[model samples]
Target: MNVDGALAPAVESILRTARERTPGEDAERISVDARSFSDALADAEENGRVPLIAEVKPTSPTTNGERTDDPVELAETMVENGATALSVLTEPEHFGGSTENLRRIREAVDVPVLRKDFIVREEQLDAVAADLVLLIVRFVDDLEGLLSAAEERGFQVLVEVHDEEELREALDAGATIIGVNNRDLARLEVDLGTFESVAPVVPEDTTLVAESGITTTADVERMCDAGADALLVGSAIMDGDVGENTRRLVNA
Candidate 1:
């Protein structure tokens, strides 16, 4: 339930902007039509490899020193390097990203795009305008309601968890796609062992995604061996040669 104090102010700004932009009529209008998460997984499986959800992150609260000013070029580079899906960080201030970046990236890429942010409320969902939505278990107080709202909006949800209890909560909320984040959000530390520790608890039917601290073929191989169906990589890809890194990680 704990989150970075800095993120609170950033989330407030995002919510305020979203409220100002959304009209009363549009706010009430519900669009239940969208692309399926199953389709994205199927495409990844058909390719005979785990789906790579490459991220276009400008900055991170944990890694405040590192930042990328250009999201459009980052998104284009990720797509060109054979990324099955694009994950764009839309939480500005803390992560230095915006929905504008996601919208722009979605417009530029043919692949499905995921809005990677700390999803707190239903109103925040409307602002993303992405095919997929990421909901962190630690941050969400109403897991079921968020999942239901995401489903109603026609956006696939990637329920993120760092521990057994959170993982169970995600499943109980009917999350078909689950991401085991290796990074400890509270302490801002990375532990590769988190995946191994939580692998046994993942249900057989759910598509598992390994998030954070993945940098090499060995890391991908390790996660794949532990039953990860896909990998959501960000800093590693963003900071290095994306094309070569993509070929190495995906082909590995």
Candidate 2:
């Protein structure tokens, strides 16, 4: 289902909370142990395949129903099924995820965990035991500063982009991991060719992560063939047996 304007209000609320919070008082801070998300992806390659960062989002505006139970169980299953890394949604309102999910998933699995959210404040970054954080290049004003800040706090950055201009901004900000989101925010439609189009301009040394709209082994192979170093898949993997679904992605 299309959710073109659905994301707007949720994002605005989070950004507002980020702006209103005082330093070291975010109340959302959970754990402080750090892991290297970039290194884990580099280690997940097998037969020259792209690594998988299996995500643990309970729900999203694009889909219906909620996954309020067994998030940790699902997370462990993904890790057990050869997940290179883990992505736990920390955005509460729209995604129905909590920092508790991130912290416990980190403790539950040894793999790197990425706090996937629309982060706008340093305090927000301090709220997880996450190895890395998703810094959407579209929402952040100082991409370079946020990149540096996350690195300084022991977390790597996944700079997400939806178009060429945002891709350039991520590159210009010295981002080591760049995520090409296929879902167009304005139209709320996914186009895999988005990654095919934007990936060529990215340098080989950078880890190119493909996000959203992938559902099958064919999609996985297509992304791998298109030069995605890693894939961040959530909804599809959540829709079936976690282990089998993840293995399909890894083998693809």
Q: Write the per-residue lDDT of candidate 2 for residues 87-116, one digit (tens) a residue.
A: 998877778888888878888889888888
Which runs of model 2 end up more than 4 angstroms from their true locations?
1-33, 47-50
* Cα lDDT computed for each candidate against the true fold: 0.78, 0.81
Error of 1 at 123 (Å): 1.1
- Model 2 quality (TM-score): 0.88
Cα RMSD, model 2 = 3.7
Candidate 1 TM-score over all chains jointly? 0.86
- Residue 110 lDDT, candidate 2, scale 0-100: 92
Each candidate structure's TM-score, on Cα atoms with residue i matched to residue i, is: 0.86, 0.88
Best by lDDT: 2
Q: How many residue pairs clash per model?
A: 0, 0
Error of 1 at 120 (Å): 0.9
